[model samples]
Target: MSLHDTADDAEPRGPRGIQSIEVGGQLLLALAHHGRPLPLKDLAREAGMVPAKAHPYLVSFQKVGLVAQDAGSGHYGLGPLALQMGLIGLQQYDPLRLATPLIEELAEALGLTVALAMWGNRGPTIVRVAEAATPVHVTMRHGTVMSLRDTASGRLFAALLPPERLREALGAGLDELATDAPFQQALSEIRAGQPARAEGDAVPGIHALAVPVFDSLGRLVLGLTVVGPGAAIDLGPQGAVARRMQQAAQALSQQLGWRGSA
Candidate 1:
């Protein structure tokens, strides 16, 4: 499906095979995938090249502001130019458009319903759902405003969203059965990187696990939740399905120019 892999006639090639560009790409990939600044030696090692060869490329990248070295610590990370490129990529890119394919794949792979939600005019709304082959009796659908305290998708925003947005969501979909102290404690735990969970809280006999997606500015953009019958879904964040769900969310986050760790 890659654009570069389409069928084409064989063409003449250079002897060195565009070595410098290839090396530059490898180094950039290393920096991006690592998600943090790296020392010169470590960056070189990650790209499978010695410092002697990598340094020259780094210097060229630095000149163009694609990479920047810390003068004191001697570490290097993505510079302004690299961030500009990422920002430009996201300019016309829609996260949902980028994530729908991933959601469908996860639903098929896990045999469950994958829901994508975002903060809407009224509250956290289910914007899309990708369901597996098996029939599910749940009534959730597009435009449904999730319960701020009952739905896993809603709680994901409560955990990491800004206070103003949280207030708006609460006004729109607060759960009557929710107790304030317990809600605060649960939000604290969820904010500590736990996937939000709700069983018989959103839908009777239904359970869900929600993983968060954040933008480059560290703002919550959407939640990816997997839903199924309580007995069929793995509610734990550590389980196989949850891990795969997290991976999919991470992929979408990256498309939005989010580099998870500083």
Candidate 2:
């Protein structure tokens, strides 16, 4: 079943009278829509509950590992149990299996390195890679952890992350980095759904273009990226690459029964 179906199957029907359960359900929805961890106040606001009333439900969720509290930031995110549940639900769709051939086709067509990445606790991890046949290529080994602030794929993934969680992941005081005009511009572009590129950031002489992949409910689940030698594929060609990658991602999402707008 798709994520939506799984959620529907798990949802309680006929309206139970328990206030706690209702609050918990609302909290879950807020987290899903936010696509990132939220602090107590923000989560309460999103759920339409006051912090005092929401605390008990959050505490219960934490105890059950349905939610996690960040040690450094004290924010709450879907915990290991929630992730396991999502994975269990996603396994029915087999995203990686569905995405393989699409990545291969993208690599062949563009003659560039193509990759699919999924977000993890730390950052986006390269779950799959299809290298170009060309002798000279950008090398991103499978299982590479992308920097949330740097590479093209990383920027797109980070853009989908919750602002608070993103700040935490980027460490404190991003304003220092904001002083750099290029860094600010890159971030602005990513937020605007435009592709981003950087030289010698992720890999030397490598340039990359990336697009976000959304699931059935319009939640970002992964990123599709193509990278190659700077001369072979520059920012000028990114639009073409992005179009193809978006098509492939949409197809893969459809195979996974995603019904959301791509």
Candidate 3:
């Protein structure tokens, strides 16, 4: 089998210049997603490219150790080179390092669980968590995926997302937004209107308030959330928590080089 057969069918369309490079990159991405060895024919079909055209690029990628071939089956898979590069990039980011103290402080002040979450491919995933220092408290495990429509963190994330991206993330159309009035209102409220607290959206008994943190580019990178029993942090207390979370998020954003309008 060739490499094209096992790749994603979707292909990006564009004008002439840089098309080859784009296609090659897409092919590589498809291979990476599969995470399994594939023959050149399978890869070409998946990428919707001719085998003859893809052969040279595959050879080039192999030379740089970006892709490797199995000795027995001659099938291709991602090589260690890409993993090493990704690790190098990840090392430069220290969101958890910057967020841990903030989460601890929030948890202590609010007497609730606090978490730092970032958008991931699967959804918004918690990166750091601080459990309330109480006998019983709300708990959210680190690396857990949370819903984008319901959770406080998810709302904050959607608020930071570009309009088109947000729409894609939600998988909802504009018409649906009108029918789903509550979601539209929540999106507007969280994105630019104000900080938000959500109750009984994701799961019962849990209440959460989240604020957005932006990077130097004014891009939303993560969110800070305080979570507790619904009764403990009612609407009134939730507002207070939102205010504090906003301040913390702003401070962190400044630290990250965001200078956008407040």
Candidate 4:
């Protein structure tokens, strides 16, 4: 028999390595693929491992906060450290490079200013902005850090990004845009608005709409937004700008290897 062929005809085979470590990894993989926290038995069953065997690994993961356990329901979830790690990777992930062309196309096609916002060390920062041909004096630009409680892009981040990072941004004195009752009300509106969010004249006379792009991992990768003169912009659910922005966002999300919106 050729070396390419397996000794046992009943099952196809490949090279084998350490079994115990592979089994442990299955538990983690199960948790990740499930897309939600799991109890001990469910986690083990998903991994094809016994509960008793999985407990030891779970204990180790919990100690480092890679896996956090809820005291009430005894569920396990990816912890703060995991979210922090993912966010760190995002800074160097070059999502803008992948997203810019699509962004430019949308801007030119719609005659609107488009921008991509991502979580930066300080807060939600506009990393790139594509302007329309007949330019308007839009307030936002590249490297402009948005105010979480004020701007539409900022509010999007405040609504979705990890709470720990939000707290850090607030601590850095980026709270100048106060979250007063009215501001809180706007945030509520954004969350309640299904599909996407819109804020009329978020920046003085400029109107904007934003839609979040979530990755397959069920995380907010970025926000894609369009800005234009308030008089011409429409924020209605069935408006032209809002629908096009959402379509572009859907395409971009797929390009980022996202198959489903979380």
Candidate 5:
């Protein structure tokens, strides 16, 4: 038989799905990518379908609360149902559970120790670690509370938190250091999305770079850090290691429903 006939008769390799629903899903994907309301024609073009073919699908979506149109502008966007569904999914996500496997993959791929740190009651605390095949000799472990004034992960959390929260976290000491020129400059750079680094300060001959992960509401969720021997880790802002770490952090943030730029 011909290719089409053969494919029709072939055994299914995975669970079957409704072809029409799958096609409709394309429109939703397109809307999500644009991240703004779109005219019918534009949305259809983005979804690779003609407007006439897309209209019925959009109508069905609207009825189900998956899509909405602005009355005045006649532009389509995600509806209330979509927002509720997204919020529910975000609430179900566990940052540590997701970060664990990702950091493991990164550690193996980059041959550098990777860690996930969340702000604890005391400070930025290391909650998970993925040791490299040849682990460095740095004194890092789960439950290690990083120094707010010294470590890369610590500085990352310090920079990302709002001023009020920072003051609460550090109390009177932060007020004292806020006037320090170098401290202000470092936090300024980090707040602008640059990764923080520590060279032989946290641990002699050990170096680290840390990038911030944010939640859906743009809150600082955690810090993803790479650690290694001083000579092996590149802590420069635009270096290869820094780029990879930042990319990983951004990807993780997106997974957590963050739509903002890193």
Candidate 6:
């Protein structure tokens, strides 16, 4: 072939990667999937390779502190460097940053505004808002602290957050709220995996449905809210908007490492 033909053939459609490195990554992925030490044979089987083929990759991984072999059982597990990398990845996982694009997509798809709220020291606070193409008549804004008893987002936190955190957030108010029947009932409904719904209660002309997003520990990380004019969106717990929000929130939760059922 001519030099020009050789050059044309060598041009890549995308960034070229080391094939051996990709093969080695499959072993690492298998280890992560099992979440426990595996014998060489089992590890190789999981990686879709034979033990002999997987040994050299494992040795290289050990040298880099990515995998460790148990002295007693000779089984391999993730090593210190892998743990460090995982922690660093988790530290960089900002829920608000990750959810911005998702909420924007939700807003566009549903034709309703979407908001992300997280528990602040004071209470549930709106951290981000994605406005719909057609603006909804609502009073929500970034940094708005939602009413714990009056808003969908607030009630979602009240229901799904850990009891210790709820106590800290409520303090003395927890004792008084314990006896409130309506508040208890609302929380029970939310704990059953139903999205919190408020219709013209928190705001005169707005309706909202809020769902919870969780992390690897199954802890509530944030609340996703869909808001629109009362006449524009379905506000029922089982409505199209609520179902769509649940699906979206579940997907986001999975991205955040949540392995629990929705």
lDDT at 180, model 3:
70
lDDT of 3 by residue, 36-154 (tens): 77898999888888888888888888899888889999898887897687557555656667878888888898888888888876667898888888723444687788777778888
The TM-score that candidate 5 achieves is 0.92
Per-residue C-alpha lDDT of model 4 across residues 181-221, encoded as one tens digit per residue: 77666666656653344455355677777888877465778
lDDT of 1 by residue, 206-232 (tens): 898999987877788989989988888
Best by lDDT: 6
lDDT of 6 by residue, 218-257 (tens): 9899999999888877877788998999999999887777
Q: What is the lDDT of residue 178 in candidate 6?
A: 80
lDDT of 3 at 70: 92
Each prediction's total of clashing residue pairs, residues at least 3 apart in sequence or on different chains, is: 0, 0, 18, 0, 0, 0
Candidate 4 residue 205 C-alpha distance from true site, Å: 2.1
* Model 2: worst 10 consecutive residues (lDDT sum): 169-178
Ranking by TM-score: 5, 6, 1, 4, 3, 2
The TM-scores of all predictions, comma-separated, are 0.79, 0.57, 0.58, 0.58, 0.92, 0.85
Deviating ranges (above 4 Å) for candidate 3: 1-93, 135-139, 163-179, 234-238
- Sort the candidates on lDDT, descending order: 6, 5, 1, 2, 4, 3
| Whole-model lDDT per candidate | 0.83, 0.76, 0.75, 0.76, 0.89, 0.90
* Candidate 6 backbone clash number: 0
Runs of candidate 2 exceeding 4 Å displacement = 1-91, 135-139, 173-181, 257-262
Score candidate 1 by TM-score against the native.
0.79
Off by over 4 Å in 1: 1-17, 30-43, 62-65, 68-80, 169-179
